[model samples]
Target: MLLADFIRDGAARLEKLYPSPEARGLVLMLCRELLGVTNYTHVVEPRTAVPEERLPELEAALARLCAGEPIQYVLGVAEFCDRRFVVGPGVLVPRPETELLVAEAVRTLQEMELDRAPRVLDLCTGSGCIAWSIALDIRDAEVIGVDVSETALDYARKQFPQGPSFIQADVLDTEQAFPYGPFDLVVSNPPYVLERERTQMRPNVLDWEPDLALFVPDDDPLRFYRAVARWAQRFLRPGGVGLVEINEALGPETAEVFRAAGFKNVRNLPDFYQKDRFVRFQTPDNQAINN
Candidate 1:
């Protein structure tokens, strides 16, 4: 069948599940993924014929789409910080908003002027995107990724076997011993979406994306932040900064949580859409544990 015919049929079906623009996008991405076509406009316009072998995969993806599975889950990968990371229904798909979290991490790491390799950590690492991106960009930096999901960490280990160490552990478990970092930076895009908001999400997301990686109790939106800030106080060295992605609307509350936990230099920053999407806080004086 011709690519245009495929798109026409696929778009029509996808529209039943997604908005027009997103449906069109899925069709275009599928064309590129299956056909190795760089220019999707050509596929949409000229209507080139699809190869015989690519049919089965496209058919399966279309079926999954009709079932309200997100395209990222169907693709089994998501792009973040201009790099590909393994993703599935089991893990939260990295979003563009998280890129702001990473960019801030990179900027802060650069400013530290470390002549030697700096240590970094990505807590609640889902796909290891943030950890791997830091290692890939900073070159000399050593990164470690920690997550409670063994399945998620397994996927991350496959993606970065030697580049960064992947650990399976819950962030809130005090019995779990994290390496004494004295890390130059620690970062995360941890679950912050409120539990109540789940029903309002699009079917493609709410139906497929894992809740453990997305939603938190609305009664305590800063649960993860409070845990991570305490961890930073213990593991991060003096002047080391922690970066995190958070709900845009909760900027003040997040800042307060970090500050109350003894983190200093607390600042909330905006994403590309001008939403309060990222926060940074530095460890002060590397305080003694009792203090």
Candidate 2:
């Protein structure tokens, strides 16, 4: 079958789900990844043809897309921090904006003059993207990721064969004793979306992504932030930093949670869209003299 024909038909079928340009882009990406063709292959070689034997597999992929399955999950990988992360039915697909959290954490670690390897902890790590990204970016850094779901942990643990240690623990269970401690940096992108905000999300996400990694109760939208603050209080070393992705609507409140927990330098950070997407806080320097 001709590549152009496949592209045309696939885009037409996906038009109802995505905008015209986006549909075409998805189709082009699918073709490039599955058939090893360039994005502009059809443009450059209008006569390019898909291998007859490969047509069935391509059609199967198109059917999945038409059914609103996310392309990343359909392809079994998602790109984060210029790295590919394994993702499937049980784990959350890593988002581009969460890369900002990794960037900020990396910058914080770089600025600190530590004599030994820096210890970092990631809370509610669905796919260990932040944990593994930090581990790979920082030399000799110790990184650990915590998640409650065994399924999510399975995916996170395999992301890097010898990368961050992925552990199973409930972040919201304050009563449970967390064994890891005294981290130089603590980061998380927990469930910040409120139940009431479900309408704002697309069906692709609502249907495919893990709810445990995506949402919070409507009455307490900042629950995970509160838990993150508590975790930082116990695990973060003096003058250490904490960063977490947050719901845009609860930015100020989320920052306040850290401040109220006695963290210093608590502030809200913006994502690429200039929205209140993250909160950064620092633990008090315990060595400072209290004159």
Tell me the tens digit of each residue's lDDT in model 2 across 260-289: 888889899999989999999998898311
The residue pairs that clash in candidate 2, if any, are none
What local distance difference test score does each model get? 0.82, 0.90
Model 1 per-residue lDDT tens digits across residues 154-229: 7788774469888888997744566556687879888999988877788778878788888899899888998888
For all candidates, the clash counts are 0, 0
Sliding window of 10 residues with minimal summed lDDT for model 2: 282-291
Judged by TM-score, which candidate is best? Answer: 2
For all predictions, the C-alpha RMSD in Å is: 1.9, 2.1
Cα RMSD of predicted structure 2: 2.1
